[model samples]
Target: MRNQFVGKLVLVAAGIAVLLVLTPFAIVPAGHRGVLTTFGKPSPEVFDEGLHFRWPIAQSMHLVGVAIEKGEGEGDAASKDLQTVKTKVVINYHVRPDAVVAVYRDLGNQPGERIIVPAVHEAVKAVTARYTAEELISKRAIVRNDIVDALRERMARHGLVIDEFSIVSFNFSKTFDEAIEAKTTAEQLKMKAERDLQRIEVEAQQKIARAKAEAESLSLQRQQVTPELLRLRETENQAKAIEKWDGKLPATMAGGAVPFISLPAKQ
Candidate 1:
């Protein structure tokens, strides 16, 4: 009977040891934290990275890695110009270290993908709806910032923090895409035509200025040659001829030729 008692005591001690060993759980690997709960009620005390104890059967712990994670989602949304756009977005985020308890309490286990994807979709829609389809294509960085800001606000309420959010792809409806392309082409053509017209106009003004200068010069030349000016020019020419002539008496005076003297007439 003493041997039987000893055997029973050994069995009891081994079982106790096994229970003790199994009761305490390591929350996660290094760089992680555990959310503890008592009978499904979350406790405010968060367990850091290490082995920790909980009530063997009634209490439990959920481990959440506070490291950043990436998630993606796609959806159709309307732009500010009332055009439908399809967008794919990627988000990088991590559970806020201090908000781990709140995250586990509200979202429970498996919160990473479930909480992030929907929030990203909502934020994308909200921001996309405020911009035009053209703006979404050309100014994607701004759109990304808007989406990030919105996600930050929404995720904050759920005890999540967003590290970065980006728009991976933005697609437009076939009709809209064609229309935008055609519109852009037309605008470029119009600008080119306007430039050409301006160049032609400048050339025309230069020609007009040159023609006016020529006409003025011709008018000045004509004004300098009046009838009165012509008579004075003839008188000067006769005086130059007489001054150049050598004095010699003509035989016409001895042969009864009439003597004559030329004089300028009054104009």
Candidate 2:
């Protein structure tokens, strides 16, 4: 009976040894940082991705993702023109690996909620207020840059780093949308009318040019006609008339539309 009791004690010791050996080792996956805590208090040690070792039962490691993470936030603000502007922003960011413990202590695990969202909201509002509604739409890229710059500066204070910030959507009031539509239609019609007017003007100019060319050609022909040309025309007409005339002369020279032929005084 004593031999059996000794065997059971040895088995219990072996099980505890296995447990202790397994407890100290941890697997830190890729794109993650492990924050170590000893005696329920966070320690300064941060472990990179790989198998890690710590005090068996007295220490623990919490994994924090160091990879770029995506988040979306939205808010509404009044433009300089007093128009209500609604903005939605998408961001890609990650906590600074070296500052993981600081982040966990200060901003907690969800830094995006505590830090990023509020910063985006405030920055967007501050920038949006500087521009009128029309300007906001036109200068969207510039506003996005400003918001990103503001967010980067703001988030870095809490151990967060921004990779990219994009303004995904901007929403305005119905009045603004309707106004834009009306303005677009009017501008399109105005452009089409101007183009038509230009086409008509071009055609009129062409017609005037053709008329000028024809008038100039006729003037050149008139300038070349001299007295010599008139006399030559008269001689040509006489030749044609002689070619058709019979070999006889008209007697008495046609009195009262009828010619009285005299027989040459009977000789």
Candidate 3:
């Protein structure tokens, strides 16, 4: 009976060992990759999501989520125009599947916080330093592109791929904000003044054109009213008066049924 009990205990221990050994072969979840390392040396082979095998004694696996992950960082940077600006930037990134081993070796476990966030902050500062505060605020897309490009290039060394990057917010100093506002207001006023001047000039041109037309009409009338034209008008008036007169002759001795008035002799 004692021998049977000892044999049964040995079998139970063997079964436990086997179970422990098989635990490392479990399936990795979706969106995750298993990075296997042997004797602290990372293997070139990476296991994708699903059941994977690793050496029970000599190898250990690190599960890295290959899905896109988000990170945010903020810092103060100088603009191209020497204005200091504070900016908050957000980045979404992921480890390159083929570079998983390299990433593990270089960045170790916490790639998002250690590698990506710092790289983004550096890129943001570097790119921001090349643009003015006003440009940073208005042309944020350009700044974001620059940052993404710079970060992608920088993080590529660590086997990280930048999925997307954006500037969350940008803030300028109080003095700078006031200055920009004042400048904008001044520009608007200047444009308004220019438009007003143009309007006045157009109105003046119209008035001058109308006065010239009136002057031209008067000159034409003066040119048409000649001495011959005045004589013709007087003849027309006399003809109309004679045509309207009644034909009855006066009884008083006038000049043979026609009244004739002799003008006084001129002195």
- Per-model TM-score, in order, reads 0.63, 0.78, 0.74
Query: What digit string (tens of lDDT, one per residue) describes model 2 on residues 1-267?
Result: 999999999999999988965687888899999998887789888889999888877887888889999999788999999999889889999989998998877777889788877888899999999999988889989998888887887788888888888888889999999999999999999999999999999999999999999999999999999999999999999999999999886654545454754467755
lDDT of 1 at 8: 100
Candidates' C-alpha lDDT: 0.83, 0.88, 0.84
Off by over 4 Å in 1: 1-30, 36-42, 50-61, 80-82, 130-132, 138-142, 213-267
lDDT for residue 15 in candidate 1, whole number 0-100: 97
lDDT of 2 at 78: 95
Point out the higher-scoring one by lDDT: 2 or 3: 2
TM-score of candidate 2 against the unseen true structure: 0.78
User: Per-residue lDDT tens digits of candidate 3, residues 151-263?
Assistant: 87778887788887778899888999899999999999999999999999999999999999999999999999999999999999999988988986565674555356769
What TM-score does candidate 1 reach? 0.63
Better of 2 and 3 by TM-score: 2
lDDT of candidate 1 over 1-267, digit per residue (tens):
999999999999999988864676645567578887777888888788877867776777778778887887789989999998889877788887788887776676555666787877788888888888889988989888888887787788877888877788999889998998999999999999999999999999999999999999999989899999999999999999999888965646757875666689989
**Ten-residue region with minimum lDDT total, candidate 2:** 252-261
Provide the global lDDT of candidate 2 against the true structure.
0.88
lDDT of 2 at 237: 99
